[model samples]
Target: MSVVSDTIDWFSDSTHWSGDDGVPHRLVQHLGYTSLTIAIAAAVAIPIGLWIGHTGRLRGLAVVSSGALRALPTLGVLTYASLYTGIGIKAAIFTLVLLAIPPLLAGAYAGLESVDRQTIDAARSIGMTEWQILTKVEVPLALPLIVGGFRSSTLQVVATATVAAYIPGPGGLGRYLIDGLALRDYPQVVAGSVVVIVLALVLDGIFVLLQRLALRNRPAPVRSTV
Candidate 1:
């Protein structure tokens, strides 16, 4: 209870984002990195995942590729990007994107694969263009899995984005934790850790709400076998 009360107190002023006379916060920098991670992951993962799932033949490829990518050490990507890009948020984003891609791609592929084949046949019989069948029938049916992937990516990014703080150029809570640890300021380290956890849970809640609303609006997908 004291931690919650104190956390609220610390955030009462948004201007606390600037490292200043106060505790020297850098939350905004972390949020920026999280956003960059999500955006890049979404861009790369969603479409490729959808395509592979829809094809069915490529599900193997999608699974294998995503699994391999997921297995790759995030530190490797982070180190590569950080060294080549010369530090800062951009390099961090590159690392986060890699972290985010696997789940997103797998989810999208899974969702699409779950789609009813009969509906697709019906769509094709009714003179729907291949693109139309894909966009309307396949994508809509796959929404749950796609959103699931998105949720996974969101969570992954939330945690991994903290690594950016290590790359320099004004990091988020990681920076705070590091600084606090360096100075032996236990309270500040605890505060920054609490902030990161809260941020991740909040982001997860928003995505869950979105997932429910989206499913609620969509008509139930026609059941079919692959």
Candidate 2:
């Protein structure tokens, strides 16, 4: 009860809202970090994934790599990066990009693979080039899964970006939690956690809508008359 009350008090305080370290500033910082990291990860992973899926080659490599990437500890990566590269947004972004890649890669390849082989054959029969088949048929069919991968990557990055505060420089909402802990301010810690959760939920909701919209726009199935 005391913790909850303190959290409410912390949120209600106008001074906290006005400072440079305020929620709005931190939120923007966090989002910037997240967006940049996700964009880089998508750029790197999606192309490779799509190629592997389309060519039906190196799939085992993709599986092994995805698993290895997933098993890596983000904190450990950050710690090592800080040790070698020194603490700053660069090291943080590097670590976060690594963290964001696996799911995006998996989704891209899996979505492409999941497309009906018969459909591909039909497209080929109709004289569609490989590029045309991929762009017109496979890509549209696989959009939901691709967007799903983006959603997963976004959520993971948002949660992990909070850990950036531990890097000893400008940071996102994680600063609240880390600083609160250092100062023994439980209310601030709770508030920071709530903010991260709310942000994740909102991003997730938007991604969900995108996935549904992609699926909804897919062409309807053909009907056969007896």
Which one wins on TM-score? 2
Model 1, span 1-226: residue lDDT tens: 7656665665675554554423344556667767777888889888887778777667777777777888978767877877788866677777778878888888877787777788888999999998898898888777766777788787878777666566676477677677767787665667778788988899889988977765886677622211
Each candidate's lDDT (Cα)? 0.74, 0.88
User: Model 1 reaches what TM-score against the true structure?
Assistant: 0.83
Model 2, residue pairs in steric clash: none
Writing each residue's lDDT as its tens digit, candidate 2 over 1-226 gives: 8999899999999877866789998899999999999999999999998998788999999999889998998888988888888867888999899999998998888888878899999999999999998899988888888888898999999999888778886488999999999999889999999999999999989997997797895664321100
Q: List TM-scores for all candidates, in order.
A: 0.83, 0.95
Candidate 2 Cα outliers beyond 4 Å, as residue runs: 219-226
lDDT of 1 at 156: 78
Tell me how far the alpha carbon of residue 198 in candidate 2 is from the true structure, in angstroms, after superposition: 0.4
Once fitted onto the true fold, the runs of candidate 1 whose alpha carbons sit more than 4 angstroms away are 1-25, 218-226
